[model samples]
Structures are given as structure tokens and as C-alpha cells.
Target: MAYWLMKSEPYEYSWSQLVADGRNVWTGVRNYQAANNLRAMQVGDRAFFYHSNEGREIVGVMEIAKTAYPDPTDETARFVAVEVTPLMAAVTPVTLAAVKADPRLVDFSLVRQSRLSVAPVRDGEWAMLCEMAGISA
Candidate 1:
């Protein structure tokens, strides 16, 4: 299965919110590239739940529960969304600073495209981050 990373501002929709809700459609992506990433996702794909802005850290893991569908927020139907279920919370949130400092993660999408909200994650990178968070990859 493909691995990915999805970012949400803590104040807007945190990892805790996702855990509480169990599952929900991940929507509101306007960027073409991020939209493409969403469309590329499939049910059962795993993703890192990242808290952007001030919290710049990966707090949990999520698995895609539903494949891409027309986004409800887009009247033009230009975007797509996929439902995700919380898989597990990290023992210690993996911070962005830590990610940037790691040589093994220099090629990571999170570092290369810092502004992208959704991006692909290589298996090696995923394993490294999970290791940093003290969780089994």
C-alpha cells in the first residue's frame, strides 16, 4: 500500500479530533498537486497525521477507509477527498525540526515541498519517522 502524509492545523482539526470522530472525509484541498495526491490514494493506504503551523509534528497514523470522490466543498467538482481512519497515535510526536535535521530524510516530500498539505511518503522515510517517534513502522 502507498504511504502518505496529511497535514492539518491543530486549531482547525487536530489528531485528537480525528481520533474522536473515528473517521471522516479529508477535504478542502485547492492546490492541483495536492488534489492529485488525494485522487491517487486508495482504500487501505496509510498516512501520517501531521499537525502543521505551530505544532509542526506528526501526531498519529491513519489509514484510508474510502477512495477519492468529488469533494463536497467544491461546487466546481475540481477536487477530491478520501475518508481516513485513525490507526494509532505516536508515542512522541515527530517534530518538523527533527525531520529537517535528519540526513536520511533530506529527500522527503515533507522537506522538499514544505507547503504541500498532502504528499507521498517513501517506505524508508515512513519507517525513519516512525522510528523517531518511537513507534513500530
Candidate 2:
């Protein structure tokens, strides 16, 4: 299964909100690369839920509940979205600072491409991140 990291602003949609809502449609991607990442997601693929802007940390995990579909939020129909269900909250949220300091994650997309909202995670990076968050991968 492919691993991914998806970012959401805390105020817009926090990890707690996802847990409460059970699941949500991950949409509104405008960037072509990020949009492609959304389209690449398949059902059952796991993702890290990163709280961007305010917290800048990976707070939880989620599973892709549905494959990509035309985004209802986009009138142009150029974008797509996927349904994601909360898997488990991280025992310890992995901060950006911690990630930056870790040599193992030096080449990660999160570090290489800070502006990307959705980024692919390599297997080794995923394993290390799960360990950092105190979660079983």
C-alpha cells in the first residue's frame, strides 16, 4: 500500500474534528501536483493527517475510504477528492522541528517541498514517522 501525507489547517479541519465526524471528503486542491496526488489515492491506502499552518505536526492517521472522484466543491471539475476515515490519533504528534532534525527524514518531500499539501511518503520514511509518533505502522 502507498503511504501519503495530507495537510489540513487546524481551524479549517482539525484531527479532533475528523475523529468526531468519522470521515470526510478531502478536497479543494488547486495545485496540479497536489491534485494529482489526490487522484492517485486508492481505497485502503493509509495517510498521515498533518495539522498544517498552526501546529505543523502530523497528529493522526487515516485510511482512504474511497477512490478519487470529481470534486463537487470545484465548479470547473478539474480537481478530484477522496474520502478518508480516521484510523488512529498519533500517541505523540510529530512536529516539523523534530522531522527537520532527523537525518532519516532529510530527503522527505515534507522537507523538500514545504508548500505541498499532499505528498508521497517513502516506506522507510513512513516507518520512521510511525515510530516517532509512537504508532504501530
- Best model number under TM-score: 2
CA lDDT of each prediction against the hidden true structure: 0.94, 0.95
Off by over 4 Å in 1: none
Q: Candidate 1 on 1-137: residue-level lDDT in tens?
A: 99999999889899999999999989898899999999999889999999999799999999999999999999998899899999999999999999999999999999999999999999999899999888888
**Cα RMSD for predicted model 2:** 0.5
Give the per-residue Cα lDDT of candidate 2 at 125.
96
lDDT of 2 by residue, 1-137 (tens): 99999999999989999999999999888899999999898899999999999999999999999999999999999999999999999999999999999998999999999999999999999999999999999
Instruction: Estimate TM-scores for all models.
Output: 0.98, 0.99
Could you tell me which 10 consecutive residues in candidate 2 have the lowest summed lDDT?
A: 26-35
- How displaced is residue 13 in candidate 2, in Å? 0.7
